[model samples]
Target chain A: MERLKSILLAEDNHMDVELTLEALGRHNLANEVEVVNDGAEALEYLYRRGKFSSRPAGNPAVVLLDIKMPKVNGLEVLKEIKGDPNLKMMPVVVLTSSREESDLIRSYNLGVNAYVVKPLEFEEFVTAVSRLGVFWAIINEPPPGSSRGIA
Target chain B: MRMDSIRSILLAEDNQMDVELTLEALGQHIFANDVVVVGDGAEALDYLRRNGKYADRQEGNPAVVLLDLKMPKVDGLKVLKEIKGDVSLRTIPVVVLTSSREEKDLVKSYQLGVNAYVVKPVDFHDFVEAVSKLDVFWAIVNEPPPARVNAG
Candidate 1:
């Protein structure tokens, strides 16, 4: 059996997290999601400090980041990740409900791999998340040195 | 009805079979998009720049570019550099779709600002499915960069 790379989901909203998990579960691909409630926790997880120090030894396949957060914003985290040489290869997808052009431009300029605007309709949202899960987790090839260790 | 904002997908692949498969997979997607197939990176650039045979082409930009790494002339990396280097074309999303899973290639593609990097699946079914998922995700899910003035 192929090992699935863990997904780091940085979303502060409880409802969004639940919906995202449900969507991924509908596709039977939500087994490896590590949910972080805010940007600070996300940083802790990614940097493998504090609680995440003993969790894993490598980076997640992809980080689904929400723009609005408590401690640090998605764009700030993105800048931090892309600014670092070791973490620059990590695939960061901005999954936010914001349709602001500024957010899109900032995310792209910061080297976000993909930016997805959350769908408004319930069924459409599910479909979007399902496709996103399948694409990023199953289809898209993670960068070299990823935790999945694909060759 | 299809959304009016949905743009075309520019595929720059040398292999005829791959092109056919990609087009078929794209057809399977819900979003209707015109697939512009080019044989090599040079031709892809020409299409983007509206040069040579593409001199009188349409003015709209493609929603995304599925670029193959190896081709007859001006390989994928070169093409990527050219596109990202150009101020007008830099915003276009370029996904590197290739068979090579070499670390150097992956690193280089990311370094050159590729939006996504997908390895061509060896299995025929998986290949088609990968292309299809890519089509749906890029064309339907992802928001493309706003149009810019093309001074060509």
Candidate 2:
């Protein structure tokens, strides 16, 4: 059987992170999520560097990226990912609070797989994340050579 | 409201049966009238580019393009490459909906910047469910590039 791929979530807000985890957990999706606080850590996780150097060898099924962060912002991380040959194909979804046209245009221009604006209401947010999780994690097939989780 | 103001879905598939099934599945959430079905990749491109028979069509691009890998004439990959390569059309989301589970196709599609890839399920019910989920995510949840981005 094919191993389930893990999901790398790069988000800065603690409250949103907790809410997202809770939403994924409600759908039994929490086990696969690996969280990072900022863009630099996200790069580390993806490249398996720094504290994440010994963690895993393969890429996550999908990256749920938040636009605003303390260190490297999500757009910078997206630019780096899409620019690299090895990491370019890994699916990255922009799960952000910004509905600004410029951000939407830029993300797509940078080759983001999808861009979803975070819902304002708690219930709507949960539903959106749950649907997003189910679609990316279970329904959509990740590209070839994506992480199949640790054996 | 202008016709182009209503963002429709463009489906490029050669298989008539699959087209019917997809339309049926999408009909649950999206209006059947909102889906513009093309029999092959050439027509798909024509519709998108507003060329040949589609010269007089609406100006705006579709919200999402559901592409099937195997098609007559240009083929899905070529269509994807054309769309992604062209600055005017690159922002429009393109999802590959095909029966092919070939690794090379998957790799190539992603390399060309496909938004998502879904393998069509053999089971009828599963196919409908998958299509419904896909529709909900792309059409409702996903924020597509603004129509103004394609003004060029």
Candidate 3:
């Protein structure tokens, strides 16, 4: 049996988080999403340190990270992830409401896998994320289909 | 308005045979795009950066980047790093379309933050069809990041 791929989602806003989870519910793919409220927590989840120390270790197929956060922020988190020799290939899609040039600039500079502008319209946002779900989870092949964990 | 923005695709590949096959497959698409090819990774970077030789390139960004691995000089991995590292170039949605699926390469490319990793079909005909389908899907549907003038 195939294991369900994990999705690392780093979002600070509760409302947006709920809405995104709901949107993902519409998809047929039941990806196990590890939700982190901020960039710091997101990093922790990826590295599996702190509370995540006890959790299983395997990289997510893709990461959906938001730009605005209290601690490290998306760009900083992106740099840490991309710069890491072991974790760099994990696909990270920037799903954020920030249209700020600085945010975009920094994210690209840090090598975010994809940068998606969260649509102001709920429907548009839903559609965009749905495509993301299909493409990343269903269509795109992960790193060689190996059963090896992130470690 | 957004859909109209994607007018062309610039495929940076070093091999001439690959160049021929990719162009032939692109012919299957409904959308008409100028699929420009640069022979090597260095040339590819120059075209994208508008540096040295590619000084007079077009105005807009390609809808997507279809990158090949294991090229001479700069190589796909490095080019991918350069594109994703550059503030202006990162959002371009690079799909690593290559032959080598070494676990290290796969892990490294995704870690480097490639949008998609598609192993090219080894057979010539299969390769053409695969590349063609990639063009079709990205050209018609994928919403590429907008033109940003500031990325270096």
TM-score, one value per model: 0.91, 0.94, 0.71
Residue B118 CA displacement from its true place in model 1, Å: 1.7
Q: Which stretches of model 2 miss by more than 4 angstroms?
A: A1-5, A148-151, B1-5, B30-33, B150-152
lDDT of each: 0.84, 0.88, 0.73
Reproduced native contacts, each prediction:
0.59, 0.77, 0.33
lDDT of 1 at A54: 74
| The candidate that achieves the highest TM-score relative to the unseen native structure | 2
Best by lDDT: 2
Q: Supply every candidate's count of residue pairs whose N, Cα or C atoms clash at under 3 angstroms.
A: 0, 0, 8
Candidate 3's residue-wise lDDT over A1-151, tens digit each?
A: 3442467779988987877777666765434667889998998888878988666657887788888898998888888988897677677788888777667656766666666778788787676676666556544557653222121
Q: Model 1: residues >4 Å from true position, as ranges? A: A1-5, A149-151, B1-4, B149-152
Q: Which ten residues in a row have the lowest lDDT in candidate 1 chain A?
A: A142-151
TM-score of chain B of each: 0.93, 0.92, 0.90
For candidate 1, lDDT tens digit of each residue in B10-92?
99999999999888899996667988999999999999999999999887678889999999989999999999888778878
Candidate 2 lDDT over residue span A64-139, tens digit each: 9999998999999999999999999999999999978778888988989999999999999998998888888877
DockQ of each model vs. true complex: 0.46, 0.59, 0.25
How many clashing residue pairs are found in candidate 3?
8
Which sequence of candidate numbers ranks them by DockQ, best first? 2, 1, 3
